[model samples]
Target: MDILDKLKNREEIYYPIERNRNTDLRFTLYDAFLAKKRFERFAPLFMEAFEEINGPCYYKSDLYKSKLGADVYLKLDSELKVAHSVKARGGFNEVMVKVEDVLKENGMLDKFDELSLNDIRKIMAAYTIEVSSTGNLGLSIGLCAKAFGFKAKVHMSRDAKDWKKKLLREVGAEVIEYDSDYTYAVKMGRLSAEQNHMSYFVDDEMSEKLFLGYAASIFEVAEQVASSGLIPSDDEPLHVFLPCGVGGAPGGIAFALRSFFKDSVRIYFVEPTEYPCMLYSFVHGEAASVNDIGLGGKTIADGLACSAPSKLVFPIVDSLIDGFFSFNDESILRAKKDIEEIDEKVVEASSAAALLAYEKINRPKNSILWITGSNVDK
Candidate 1:
């Protein structure tokens, strides 16, 4: 069967023909280095803004070799402080960087440490942070913005969970619900921010700052891996499976990994069967909706239910990602259950995609399953 037929059938694997590690990328290693510095520089503000965030954003790695019968390590971004998801990395940093920019522009940067919380609040109350999300990203942005005393507006798609919307509102964020899908929510949210000079839209599909926030997390991961005595080399390369949404989170990490490992690491993305937007974008060489392939883009993994790949992240994903996998709702749920049984930890469906993808791939000795988040109310 051809690729289209296979997609319709919900087949597991698709490797793009144009994946080249040596491809010339517009965003260089120096850019990622600067992004890392920016993330680190904002650590003090992140801690001050969110009481739940005590220290630097770092992940724990547990070797689950025996239970899963592989040499795979579980990289638990799910245990991330604050938002309890990988979105906390990008979403929170996006707001923090923007806040810093505002402070610098107003000549308040040097006085940041001397300013009281109420003083910071007075300054931030004039601006608003806006974002569109199916669930996790909105929660991250809303929680961070409210904590920093900035008004937040989250444009939520139809697939967003009711609990997520409720949580945003409880934290003082204005939640705007749309009956349409993620793409439409993004369109409306961007338009709304454009009309308001005081509002800043955290564009998941095109924000380099958001991408950099995600990319900076890789530095922590590398340090953890080296401590565990598993180094990525030509003979024993690392295999990483990440759950992909609109592509910013996974694409950013993949870009940074390629830069660091230089073909010594293989990165794969897993998406819901009908909503494989990144995969579709990689194949077509441009950003397009999954609707073009006759799929409605519905799934149990709501966080991965985007209809189109990110235009900003696609080129990076295309050049760096080694393979793509798609799984249906049943498989995702099954994987969730199986992981709970094996590790005694219940993950959300979106985070379970990495497990399912890891099982299907020909994994190397140093394989890592990147668990994005856990908001499942078990």
Candidate 2:
């Protein structure tokens, strides 16, 4: 009912990471391997758009490690290229791959390849793509869709920030605002795309490309950690705290990390107390949504205002993540203010969720928190 009450109600859940999984539905090392290859294919597109993608963009963000009394490092998705958020990774990959899929199916692969960038624009302009989002994903999809000359439509819920909506419009996407939640926006986007043959829908709840794009971060994180000479052994385990909305970003990364580190890594997802959808879903063992409990989906962290866990990522989340925690709006603001004063870094509300989780863990030697986004309004 209240902030701390939500934390008190948390049902702790985790699964052991191993080489083989008995269940057909649960994710395994093979899935991580396949996801890596998918990411490699799209990583080039990311580089083409913004000089660099997976490797050069991620770095350590400044945080008050001593104040938290843990050796905490931040994976700076806040400074990532494109839309300055983790969403860009997934959104870009989904749009690019979808365009290619349509081209290949139409028997235009050779024709599409022969065209120059400007010439390709003419070929791409005839198609359309749509996606539903709270905010950041729309920015990524809209910007990427526009780049490839698609008539883009972004369906947004009331929870989306005004600046994000305006940004999508400025980038040539048809911005449709709904007086509803994310699920409703996504439903409408799906319907609209289904009505037209040339239209493609990037379903955030089920897009494997989006999941693969997020999983790609694992390679870079592993490389960066290895280069820094910090080995997370069984004695001193590695802890990573991440912000969760629809669960794709954290779930994908968790799947990869679990495969890479085996039992040495622990992944935790943090969320707005009112909208801890994934925690409820994992604990309930089926599907769950905030709306089922009469939540209107209000939160300061707009990017994390999803009312439900994504169906595609929920199974992987249940299989991979080590923990989940929720906090109130005030907690997000307090952490943002305190960390800004202490660390001299300005992070958005969703980005500060990792810091909230950091305080809750008794991590050993190595720990990394993901600063997933910073698309605050000016």
Candidate 3:
């Protein structure tokens, strides 16, 4: 059976809480301006970093109206490309829309011509895939694969939430569930790509595309600071704290900060004490496995649960990261609660982890904290 048929055969997964279907999440014009300002402020930093690695690329920033208000969106400029949602916890459809926008913008409508037909049956095909946590990425990857005459697969852990798995199936990804966790899912995905002779691994953990996509966050922050008159003087370094999981986000941020600020800013990394692969690596002065440190622990922050550091990110971490901070689940939870109390907005446990560590470290005033994602399922 074809992917669409297979998706039709799969059952829909339900969640205990009522899912928010309203796409008109409200954001004030001022808020939109703030987000755009942030993007503009950081655009140069992102451009410079991306140029160093992958040449020139265009950027798109817009507010996505969702049940949770406006979400910031970003993408890489490529002939056949994928767009990623900033929300770490958004589901499949959100990701699909972003990819569709990219395809539409690039005028690559012909790429999907063959897949639009029902008669053609091909055993294997090459696909430009995009991946992220939850099933949202699966939807985009599957849709782009279908539109562009390619096959797509999404890797998810057995621990992945049930709704996410269903969403993956709905989006036409052959959802491959690993026996272990998300880290293992990534390893399995690499192997599966090799065995299937696929065009590329839509790797979030190690791919330059994925890392550079996130580095845009740093650019946005830099712009926000400068425009808001928050930029420190030349002699005063901007200390940046970021939460590390597989090291993609932190690695990207560090690369941008180091390139722009050089010795002007200090970069600090934060990881959950339960799965502190990055911290262990930093402390040992070399890359080390999570198993070697025996640091595994259960936490609500599943996104940060990485068993190993990415080989691609190690060099950047060694050179750019100044220090590391470790925090327990309790601290992350407290941070989440504190953010909610202060802003009345629920920040995910992982998102709050960086700010939590920053508070604990008591760094110099004006230090910047990278609030990575808003994927808190609760």
TM-score of each: 0.93, 0.86, 0.64
| Candidate 1 wrong stretches, greater than 4 Å | 16-18, 57-66, 375-378
Worst 10 residues of 3 by lDDT: 72-81
lDDT of each: 0.81, 0.73, 0.51
Q: After superposition, how far is residue 98 of candidate 2 from its true place, in Å?
A: 1.6
lDDT of 3 by residue, 261-296 (tens): 666777777777766777566546677776664455
Scored by lDDT, the top model is 1
What overall lDDT, based on C-alpha atoms, would model 3 receive against the true structure? 0.51
Q: Estimate, for each residue in 78-125, the C-alpha lDDT of model 1 and write its tens digit.
A: 777777778877887788787788889889989876876677778899
Tell me which of candidates 2 and 3 scores higher on lDDT. 2
Q: What digit string (tens of lDDT, one per residue) describes model 2 on residues 249-334? A: 78777777877887788778888876778876765666678666655457888889888898887866655766677778888888
TM-score of 1: 0.93
Question: Clashing residue pairs in candidate 2, if any?
Answer: none
